[model samples]
Target: MGLPLLMLASGSAALAAPAAAANDETCRPTIESPWVRAAPPGAKSLAAYLVLRNGCGTAVEVVDVESLDFGTPMIHRTVEEGGVSRMRPAGKLVLAPGESLRFEPGGLHLMLMQPLRPLAEGDVARVRLVLADGRRLFAQFPVRRSAP
Candidate 1:
């Protein structure tokens, strides 16, 4: 009985060790040069752009995004269909090993709609991004008057 119990405990610990390591040293994705596109007065919707660089050995995917400034901050991509450009939810943004993804106009971006309050220059918006492995990356995106 004692031998079996010891073996069981050892096996359980072995299984949990990797999971703990994965959580401890997971990928870190940084958002750089984050800015919101300048919107016209009375406009209810805006878009934010940034560059996401993965600084980890393993690849990571951005599965979700959230912000209090917008009704719903969603990952979006612009596509041209039938000579009309439309923006649609990206659902998820995946990055390969040591890869960087850029979000800008006519490309992947954040759709910020129905601003709770007016978003003006110098207003830094707090944003949260959830990775596929349940890790949350945060960034304070500065509200700018134009896209750079």
Candidate 2:
């Protein structure tokens, strides 16, 4: 009887360990230091920057972006061609396990166009990041008067 009890306890412990690991993996990527550049009055669009950290063991892809304050929110990247800078669409951003991606000026960023209303310094905009795995994460980006 004593041996049977010990075996049962050890089996339960082994089962619980896997369950804890699964829980950790389920907690997808995290967004850090999110902010939006404040545009001048009557400007058609603005830029947003942030850092995405993947805490899970598998890779995750950001497929789409949505914002209530802007008509269209899309990922974009800045490229230099013969010293001329141009902006282009970034199809999808994939973050590997334990990796971090930065979206900053002169690099990858979010192009927020057609503001639903005028935005000013210190205002907050809510943006949703849709992952390819069907997980949606919401972030509040504060409007800054200047770039960092």
Candidate 3:
């Protein structure tokens, strides 16, 4: 009985190692030039853009995007079908090693909806990129009228 219990403990320890490694600094993705576009007064929705780069050796998925400043913030991609451009909510985003995904106007972007308050230029918005492995990367995006 003691031998079996010891083996079980050893197996459990091994299983916990990967969960600890999920938050490893080396595996964390990087974000560059994160900024939110200033919206007109009374506007219910706004757009934010950023560049997400994965420098890790393995692929990672950005499971969700969230913010406390807005009621709903989601990842969106602009698509063109039959020469008509439409914006749609982009599902989970997966980044391969050494890949940099851009969120820019007329392309992929973050849809900031239901602003809690009017955000003006020079203000900053706090957002988080939640990874599939339970790691949350927080970012502050400055509000601007144009691309930074």
Candidate 4:
């Protein structure tokens, strides 16, 4: 296979931390507990969950998400309205500085589509987290039957 084309945006690299630490230059974000659910064969897509935090100083905008194993990867969130629930595209979420956002079932998540191969337990999926500043962060999501 060839190298994947990076879909990066020149939106001023971490020019301003979106949610909390807009001015904190000392801010370094982190991704924790990243995991993807095990799917049956022939499954078209999968949902990955994790915790994103920007503790201390500064802010960052997660511009986009991409994966080599999947053709399409998008950040989305589950919303409840009028007693009904649905999934919608979460366009550039901003987390308050010193705050942590949880992406779990029935909440914010990464939708990985068009899997290159079926991922099962013990397998891992690697994804790129693009920040607004044109910087990129790599995350490895282990496949699991359920949240650990």
User: Over the stretch 28-134, how does candidate 2's per-residue lDDT look in tens digits?
Assistant: 79989999998889989999999999988888899989999999989999999899999999866889899999999999999999999888999999998888866
- Put down candidate 3 lDDT per residue, 1-148, tens digits, no spaces: 9999999999999999987676676668998999999988888988999999999988889878889899998988999999999998887799999999999999999999999988899999999988888788899999999998
Q: Give me the overall lDDT of model 2.
A: 0.89
lDDT of 1 by residue, 1-148 (tens): 9999999999999999987877774448788888887677677888899999987777788998888777878889999999999998886678987899999989899888788778777777778888888888788888888765
Candidate 3, superposed: residue stretches over 4 Å from native: 1-19, 23-26
Clash pairs, model 2 backbone:
none
Models 1 onward score TM values of 0.85, 0.81, 0.85, 0.78
Model 4 scores a C-alpha lDDT of: 0.83
Q: How does candidate 2 fare on TM-score?
A: 0.81
Alpha-carbon RMSD to native, per candidate: 2.2, 4.4, 2.7, 12.3
Q: How accurate is candidate 1 locally (lDDT)?
A: 0.84
What's the distance in Å from true for residue 66, model 1? Answer: 0.5
Q: Let me know the TM-score candidate 4 reaches against the reference structure.
A: 0.78
CA deviation > 4 Å runs, candidate 2: 1-25
Alpha-carbon lDDT of model 3:
0.91
TM-score of 3: 0.85
Can you write out model 4's per-residue Cα lDDT over 24-140, one digit (the tens) per residue?
Answer: 445568899999999898899999999988784555678789999999999999999999998899877776678888889999999999999879899999988788866676899
- Residue 70 in candidate 3, Cα distance off native in Å: 0.3
Give the Cα error of residue 72 in candidate 4, in Å.
Answer: 0.3
Instruction: Score each candidate by Cα lDDT.
Output: 0.84, 0.89, 0.91, 0.83
